[model samples]
Target chain A: MRKTKNSVSYNKWGYIFLIPFMTAFIIFQFIPLLNTIYNSFFENYLVGLNQVGPTFIGLDNYKSLISNGDLLIYTRNTLILWVMCFVPQIILSLTLAAWFSDASLKLKGTRFFKTVIYLPNLIMASAFSMLFFTLFSERGPINSILIQLGILSKPFVFFSSTIATRTLIAFMNCMMWFGNTTILLMAGMMGIDGSLFEAAQVDGATSTQVFFKVTLPLLRPILLYVMITSLIGGLQLFDVPQILTNGTGDPMRNTMTLIMFLNNHLYSKNYGMAGALSVMLFIITCILSLIIFKASGHDKRK
Target chain B: MENKKTKGMSVHARRTFSYIILVLVTILCLFWFYVLFINATRSNGELQSGFTFIPSTHLLENWKNLRAGTLPILSGLKNSLIISCSCVLFSVYFSTMTAYAIHAYDFKLKKFIYPFILAIMMIPTQVTALGFVKLVDAVSIFRDSPVPLIATTIAAPVTFFYMKQYMESTLPLSLIEAARIDGSNEFRTFNSIVLPLMKPAIAVQAIFTFVNNWNNYFVPALVLKSDDKQTLPILIARLRSADFLKFDMGQVYVMIAFSIFPVVIIYLFLSKYIVSGVALGAVKE
Candidate 1:
């Protein structure tokens, strides 16, 4: 009788503990996600001053997105940007992590380096974007330095062209976030047994040899995690581009990201198109995430 | 012994090379700050003249100009504090409760719920932006109020994920069982026995949740449209695009610095927690 009573009490307590989170989750995340998917099929109208009502429109929204040439450009740009950002970020983060993990370096101030490097990640995205704006503008610091050093005779408009703008943005993003990847890799490095390094040392391993063979191999899972997540995050890149371009995706809309395009539709009162774009971005992000996950063998590990 | 000496010299050379690389990275890390610092000290015209490494005397003047702006930066700071603190509180409260439930229970639905939270972690907030806005609009929570609970910095996914993961890993069921055997009620057991032991997790989650909320821009931007209700990021954006460039640039930097300052301070204090917190949240079984 007492055991039964205890079990019954346990279930009751479970419900109580779950009530707040479950309520918030349903209200905040789950319902909104479902509504977004549902709204993608409807034509939303602002009938009165503020009332938003949806008229069912089937797959017209998705059809419109496919037809819109700008959408295609946005998708292409997003793809290019992700590649530019993710690839270098992974390589540099791996290199930095491996370097830091070196026993011979006897790296003092690990904590200081970690904190300083992650500093950019902590700064508000808007702030970082603004900082970059000041640093990379036509008359900004970068151009001035290049000009003074005679690398260029005049101030080069960093954001003047499409490719230059995107490349600059990608480079800045890599700089800002490589620290985070480094930290994760560092954590993974810590988990590896030290005796393996000793064995490598005994085997007449050079620094490069130990790094390429031991460190890189051991850190593959962590690298994979960082790469996959960065890919996912990079695909959703909105704030930096949005703020940097002053919300227009300027320079002939060259840097317009997929999320920015979706946002544009939303602000333009085209909820259906926005929804469709969202779903497309979602699928792309998911596919990329899955590819990285599979390639990293995260699935096999589990 | 002679071979050992050569090996020692090679190690020394390697260390010197590594130190050079470290110094290079450290300088690169400080490069952005150096640029910002130089700009902050320069006059507007001087700033446009390209990146001079020299510091100017306009620092105090620019700060004074920033202070005298119409936007209440101090109030935005206060709002950020209130919002971030509340978010931490709510996240901790709910996450601990949910964690306790998942940790202690073996109900028919336990298996379903545990993985559900983990799966949701993979869903980025951008996917749910449109739906979240509509939900907030429907609720009309922020319609009449200056501080909208539904729209203003309240709803977050990563917080829930972090809390749930923390609870599962840290809150052992044995302690709860002991408390229950001693005739402690469920709430009492959680409050006295469980919550105390979960301090480390709480601290970790609190710092992360606070930082995320404090830096959050997109959702708050979509939901809270009122100028007064605007958070720091939105305010910064407004200042960025505002007319009166001469009057606004200094104020913009000040506001930018203002928004970044608190997070920087908090990060300094809680830098250690970030690694563990991220690990717990990101990697899962």
Candidate 2:
């Protein structure tokens, strides 16, 4: 009887503690998600409270989105930015983590290096936007230095060119985040048993051989984890482009990311169109994540 | 003797190469700080030069002007602190409670819930942003108010993920079971025994959440309409694009300094936990 009562009370307490999170999730996350899917089929307007209803429009929103030229361009730009940024990001992070882990280097001031590298990640996007703007603007330091070094005859308009703008965004993303990825990878490296390294060393393996044969293989799981998370994050890229490009997606809307396009639809009060885009983005993100999980061998365990 | 000598030479050369790489990385790290710091201090004229490493005396004046801007730098600082602190508090309390429940108890829904959380981790924030905005506007909470809670609360997902991961690994269920056997009720057991063990995890989550919230721009830009409620990031962005290149450059530096100071200070003090906490979260189970 006592055991029964105790278990009953424990269950009640558990439910009570869980109520807040569940409530927030249902109201905020789950319900909104359902509404978004539903709204994607309607023509929505920002009507007053008396007429706060959506007009049914079926698949028109999705059809329009598919045929939109700007949408196609945004999608292409986003992919380019992600690839340019993410490839170098993963490589640099792995390289740095490997270098830092080398026992022979015994590099002094590892903490200082780590802290400084991670500092940019802590700064708000606005400050970073401002800082980058000051650096890359036509009269900004980058152009000035290039011209002064006789590398360029004149100041090049960075934001005015699609390639330059996209490259700059990719560069900023890589610069700010490689530190975080490195830290994550390093942690993964540390978890590898010390015995493995010692055994490789005893077998007359060079450090390079030990890293390739032992470390890289061991770090694969964590590397996959990092890649998936970065992929999700890269898809959500918005702040830099929005702020740096002055929110118009200027220089011919060349840097208009998916999120920015979604934002534009929202601002125009085109709820149906925005919701359709949101669903499309969601489906694409989910499918890509699923593919990555499968490719990374996470699916086999389940 | 010849083989040994050659082996020694190769090792030495490798060591030298590694040292060179380390130096190069260290310089790279310093270069970012130098760029931001130098630009922040330069006059508009000198800023056009791009690579000036010399310090200028305009920092103080820039700071004063920054404070006097339309948004008032201090107000941005205040909003940032309030949002970050409140979000941290909410995340820490609820995350601890949820983690405790998940870890300490075996219940009917446990299996379904655990994997659900992991699956949701893959859903990018962009996919949810539009839906969240509509939901928030639909709710009456921010009906007439300028600030929307949705923008601030979207941070809950990452916080929950970190806390759940930490709790599963660091916490031992036996401890909670022991507390129950001692006649402590569930909340009491959690408040006393479990909460103390969670401090390290809490500290880690707190710093990450704080930094993320403090630097947040995109969500708030969408949700917030009033200038007074605008956080530092929005303020900086607004100031940067303002037609007046005439606005005090000194103030802009001051604003940058203000935006960076709190996180830097916290990071300096708790640097050790930051690395360990993230490592624990990102590495596979």
Candidate 3:
């Protein structure tokens, strides 16, 4: 009788507590999601003083986005920039994680190193981009230094060159995030059992071989998590490039990303195209997340 | 004897290599910040002329100019603080409460809510941002108000997931049973007992949520249209594109520096918690 009463009271309390979160989730997130998909099917925009149709146009937004080829170009730009950053970021992170987590190394001042490295991650992306903009401008310190060092006869304009601009963006992103990636990877590394490394040593395996054979495979789950989150973040890469290029995505629009493309539509009050692009982004994120999961060979049952 | 000597030398060599790499990477991470601060002190003319590692005397003048400029920077700071703090409070408290509900009670929707949260975590906010803005605009109260920004974060799925993971390991049910036997009501027990017990998790989530909310530029930029309502980031962007001001680079640097100064201070104090908190989040997943 007591147990029955306790269970009943607890269940009542449970629902009462969940009410706030559920209300917000449904009203804010879930409803908005459905609304986005609904909006994608309708044409909505503004022309000077006139408001255009919220007219039902079945699949027309998607059709126009694909046919215009801007969608594909922006997607390519986003992916390329992501790859450029992720490759170096993962490599640097793995190396650092290896060194820091190695119990045998017993390296000193790691706390200091970790603290310093993670500082960039704390700064706002907009502020970081602004700093970069000042530092890399034609008459900025970097160009001035290059001239002084005789690396260039004159100041090299960073923004005008597509390669220089993209590289700077990639470099800035890698710096901001590699610390975070290192910390995550280190957590994965430290979780691995020590006996495996001991056994590898007993078999006369070098550190390199042991890392390849034991650590890499065991670290797969964390790596998969990192890759997917990074991919998602990369897809939403907006503020860095947005501020760096002053919302232009200039020098032949090579630096323009998917989010920037979406922002352009939203800026012009073209809700239909914005909705379509958002849906495309959603679908792309789901598909790519699945692909990375599959490629990582993770078992769901685990 | 020869083999022992060689092995010792190799170990020393490896340590040296590690230090070199770590120091070089550290320099890479912090070099730009050094330049930013250094330039913040120099005049626009001095800045354009050359780079200097040494500090200059123009910080106060730049600050004065920045204050005198059209940007409402002080207001931006206050707005950012209010929005981020409120959002952090709502996000952590409600997320904890929701997680507690799932962990402690044998409710009907127990299984459903957990997976539902995990699924929502996969959906990025940008994907739903258009609809969110439209809905906010449609509702008179929410339109142009920061309520939607602070309130929507109450359904923070990632924080919920983390709290659930924490509760599983740290929060035992026997304690709740004991509280029940003591004739304590549910809300009282949660407020007095569970909250104190969950401090470490709460602290970690609070910092992450605060920083994320503070650094957020997208939704706030889109939602807050008025100059006074805008946050520091939007103001900085305005200051950046303020072409009519003769593009005062010194003032620009000062503004950017000021924008990040509080975050840098917070980071300096809580970096250990922040770094370890990150690792903890990743490992539990």
DockQ of all candidate complexes: 0.56, 0.55, 0.80
Shift in Å, residue A194, candidate 2? 3.7
lDDT of each: 0.74, 0.75, 0.89
lDDT of 3 at A253: 95
TM-score of chain B of each: 0.84, 0.88, 0.96
1 or 3: which has the higher TM-score? 3
Order of quality (TM-score): 3, 2, 1
Which wins on lDDT, candidate 2 or candidate 3?
A: 3
Error of 1 at A256 (Å): 0.8
**Candidate 3 whole-model C-alpha lDDT, 0 to 1:** 0.89
lDDT of 3 by residue, B238-270 (tens): 766667237788988899899887899999899
Measured as a fraction from 0 to 1, the native contacts recovered by model 1 come to 0.55
Query: What interface-residue Cα RMSD does candidate 2 give after superposition?
Result: 2.5
Instruction: Name model 3 segments beyond 4 Å from true.
Output: A298-302
Per-residue lDDT for A206 in model 3? Answer: 67
Q: B1-285, model 2: which lDDT tens digit per residue?
A: 997787678778876776676678668656755666776676666664456668887776666666555766677777777777877777677877876666766677878876776676666655666777786687776642333443335326566777777777778777877887888888888888888888888888888877887888766766766656767887877877787366555455556666766777788898877866766777656
What docking class should model 2 receive?
medium
Clashing pairs in 3: none
